[model samples]
Target: MIIHTDRDLSLSGMETFTPKTFNIPELVGIGAKNIEEHLKLYKGYVSNSNLIINKIKEYEKDPVENVYVLGELHRRFSFEFDGMRNHEYYFESLSDGKKEINKDGELYKKIEIEWGSFENWLTQYKAIAMTRGIGWVILYHDKQTGHLLNQWIDEQHLGHLTGLSPVLCLDMWEHAYVYDYPTSEKKKYVEAFFENLNWDKVENNY
Candidate 1:
């Protein structure tokens, strides 16, 4: 809950992850109350991620007796870790106020190359965000193929394309917009997100 401008996340070993503080100002349609609550959820993810790691280490001592518990904790770790990272990306994109996507930037060029035009890409990405589930719509840069790909991550951790780096992340979870807009009006929330996006931060991610 320390709101700072720096976007880099610190992860030291297994149990040490410091939740990032985002300097997000008042947004367009997303209210201060919503962000304040969302930041608390992000903090929970960070804390739970660390807790899972610590519990796993403790359980490792009695490997046979705690094997089942250790397995469950290991599986749970990704959910917490990805939740922490995804919120970081989502919050960071909305920081430092709204900035238009630079037409001349590398990210823009890649979007055009991949989806024919920027609008086309936006249309597809928005549609993906409307998928009926609580998850994230992400635009990722696949380093192996040297291309950008759009993905829908189910429940923060599932359905993420392996080896790809996320360039932009949109939280589609109801908790993301429920405070501001009803479920039927989530598209408005999506529009508000784009309106408040800091394209400079997103471009840096790419």
Candidate 2:
């Protein structure tokens, strides 16, 4: 078994992470109560991430004795960290209200190149969001290949593409839509997501 050292974790001596505040206005379809509750969940992830890091440092006093504990903490660290990061992407996309995608922009051109047209890409991406299970549908830009790829990330971290930058992220978890729609109506939630998306923020992410 491979044991993770502090260097392997890469969180050593790092400052604690603070939760970011989002200025989300009243959205269509999705309710204010939903955003309020979702923000609380985001804060939880941020708090847990900092808690996990501090715990790891405390446990590192005796690496040999705390090996097993350290191993589990290392595994859990990704979940909290990714949870925090994914929410940042999701909430930021909804900030400053909705704005249409720039059709002549680089991001739009890239999508057209990859999927033949923007409509085709939107159809396919919406389908990905309806994927079975509670998780997130992410549109990532793979710097290595210089291409855009849509992915389904299980929970907070599983199935994430390594080395790719996330451009758009849709939270498909129950908490994301339970307040606004029933589980069977999540497709409506998906549509609402696009309707309220700040494409400018997404394009900047590219």
Candidate 3:
């Protein structure tokens, strides 16, 4: 059993998420399905494991002990709830040395404003992806200002898109699908990723 303080859940200083308005998207699409499958495979053990880690990250200072036995009700399903949906991205040229026309693509415009250039953004994204443990490498967007911030998390429980809201997230957690797919074949997983994308939800979030 473990407990987490509000401060730990809030990231460094991102204190805007409230349970009433902060809705987790419905776990749909390949990515969502993968997350669901990952949860089921672990059968709640993962949640228990995270609870311990969350306590270590959040409540060591309290000196109080709380034990919680997560029941079936707390089961984590695929991200399936109203307001939660897959995201969409429009192709933007990643070439260097030139500033091109807007071409009227929503994602292209957003990327330009947030990251300077698509090339620069992707370079940073790839770097984050390969840097650590399994989880996700996300490009979080600030809904108000359209800023892009790169972040990663271990388990969906830990990472926050500091400074910006989450615009995009790529799950790198091995359990997300590494069982059905071999761990060495990440390229295939990346390719299959396109099969279950829900861009409409992402556009709505923006």
| Alpha-carbon RMSD to native, per candidate | 6.2, 3.6, 11.0
Q: What is the RMSD, in Å, between candidate 3 and the native fold over all Cα?
A: 11.0
Best of the candidates, TM-score: 2
Q: By summed lDDT, which 10 consecutive residues of candidate 3 come out lowest?
A: 86-95
Q: For residues 1-206, could you state the per-residue lDDT of candidate 2 as single tens digits?
A: 33446454545455579899888988998999999999999999999999998898788777889999999999998999999999999999999989999999999999999999999999989999988998999999999999999999999999999999999999999999999999999999999998899999999999
What TM-score does structure 2 among the candidates reach? 0.94
**Where in model 2 is the C-alpha error above 4 Å?**
1-13
- Model 3, span 62-136: residue lDDT tens: 434421322221223222211121111211111111233343668667777777987777668766766557666
State the number of backbone clashes in model 2.
0
Model 1: per-residue Cα lDDT over 1-206, one tens digit each: 44324421222345468889899998989999999999999999999998997787678767889879988998899999999999999999999889999999999998999999999999999999999989999999999999998999999999989899999999999999889999999999999999999999999999
Clashes of each: 0, 0, 12
Q: Candidates ranked by lDDT, best first?
A: 2, 1, 3
TM-score of each prediction:
0.93, 0.94, 0.49
* Best model number under lDDT: 2
Error of 2 at 54 (Å): 0.6
Q: Output the better candidate (1/3) by TM-score.
A: 1
Clashing pairs in 1: none
